[model samples]
Each structure stands twice: as structure tokens, then as C-alpha cells.
Target: MSDILFTSSATAKNGRDGHVKSSDGMIDLDLVNPAENKEGKGSNPEQLFAAGYAACFDGALNLVASKKDKQIDSTTTAEVSFMKDKEDGGFKIGVTMNVEVQGVSPEDAEELVEAAHQFCPYSKATRGNIDVKLVPQAIE
Candidate 1:
């Protein structure tokens, strides 16, 4: 069982080529079908999911850093790919989270990223259900 901290709702009309709006009126945007336009004229489900995962993973990293009494001055980029499962006859997603941790040693950063992956809700949710790769990037 889980206790809810907050809840959000959004509705999409006309499928992938339509419009989506959040209940709070914060997110209102038009969606373009990726099939029609590879570089969609507007937002798409894959983009939205990538954004959410990026934010959530960042937060999870921060939380883990705080717990460990460490500070991370970095950013995470989530690259999500949506592809059709030819054999399964449906769509599936692949995710790669590139974590660039600043103010920490490369080894430490790698450790923290692994820990964050373990703690991130999105990671846990997608584990075994999807293919996710966590890549730790060194600060240049």
C-alpha cells in the first residue's frame, strides 16, 4: 500500500494527433502524430514521458544525495525512444538516463547514480517491464 502525496490528471482528445490538457490548466498543448511527422510539430506521448521521467529522476537523485549528506551539482537527461514491437504487435519504450554529476568524483557519481536508479519511482516502475539504461557521465 502507498499513501498519496499528490495527484495530477490530464485528458487527451482525438488520440495522438489531438490536444491534451491538465486538470489544473497548467499543461495545455497540441499533439502531433510521430508517424506523420518525425519531428513532431507539437508535443507527443514519448516527449511527455521523457520530460516526466527526467524530472522525477532528478528529484530522486537529489533526495538520495540529501540522505547521503552529499551535494550534486549536475543534470540528468532522459532520452526516450518509442518503437513498435514487431513481434508483439504493439509499441514499447526504451529509456536512457544520462546523469552528469558535478562536484563529485567519477566513482562516487557512478555510485550515486546507481543508488538513484534504485530509488527512483520511474525506474522501479519500469524495471523488467521496459528496457532502461542508466549512464553516468563524467564532468568535462
Candidate 2:
């Protein structure tokens, strides 16, 4: 099945690509090289996955907090570790969420973390289908 809502252009370099669209229905894509400049500057699949995972998990955490009637005052950072699984022919993704919720007790934090894990879209998607791990910790 071909799914074409709109047409777009794409540019890729060093595994890093960019996607952009215009009002005239023109889309442009560019590939970025994360390691083009330096060792840590190169772009890789792991980095892209990490970015997606971090954003998704953080948003889920916030939603969980809101549902618990708790206000998250500080920032929530996510560290996604992508490990290679040679036998599986795919990489394993591990998530470490460092939540900065001040004034929230340990129990409350644990609750929020659990809720986040349950509610995170990424977590659900990556769970079972792919190898994923979560380490939720509060920085109060």
C-alpha cells in the first residue's frame, strides 16, 4: 500500500536527514552528519532514536504528573541507551528518566514514575516488541 498525503523532498548526509515542507505542497529533506565535525558530533540512528525516546518519555511523565494532581516544577531529562544485540539483529533500547519534581515525596515520585511508564507512548511501543529498560529516578 502506498500512503501519500503529500509529496516531499529529502536530503541525506552522514545518516542525518532533514524533512521540511512548504505551503505549496513542496517538501524538502536533508540528511545531517552528526560526526562530520567531531567524534560526538556525528549523526547516527541511536541518536535519532534517543531524541524520540527522550521527548516521548518526558511528555508521558508530565501527563502522569498532571493526572496525579501534581505540578512538575523542574525539568525532566531522559537518557536513552541503544545497545546492539547481534543475535537479535536489532538494537536494544534502554531509557533512564531523571525527573526533577521538587516537593514531591519518594512515594509520590515512585507513583509518578510508574504512571509515566504505564502511560508513555514510547514505552508501550518499545515494550515487548523491542528490548527496553527503564530507570526512573527523582531529583528533588
Instruction: Find the candidate with the highest TM-score and give its number.
Output: 1
lDDT of 2 by residue, 1-140 (tens): 56778643434434444433334544333434443534443345555566667777778878878877898754556666656677778756566666665658777777777788788877787777665545455556
In model 1, what is the error at residue 49, expressed in angstroms? 0.5
Report, for every candidate in turn, its global Cα lDDT versus the true structure: 0.89, 0.62
Count the clashes in each prediction. Answer: 0, 20
lDDT of 1 at 64: 91
Candidate 1 lDDT over 53-140, as tens digits, reads 9999989988898899987777999999988988789988899999998877888888889998999998999989888898987574
The alpha-carbon RMSD values of the candidates against the true structure, listed in the order shown, are 1.4, 5.6
What is the C-alpha RMSD, rounded to one decimal, of candidate 2? Answer: 5.6
The local distance difference test score of model 1 is 0.89
TM-score of candidate 2 to 2 decimals:
0.63
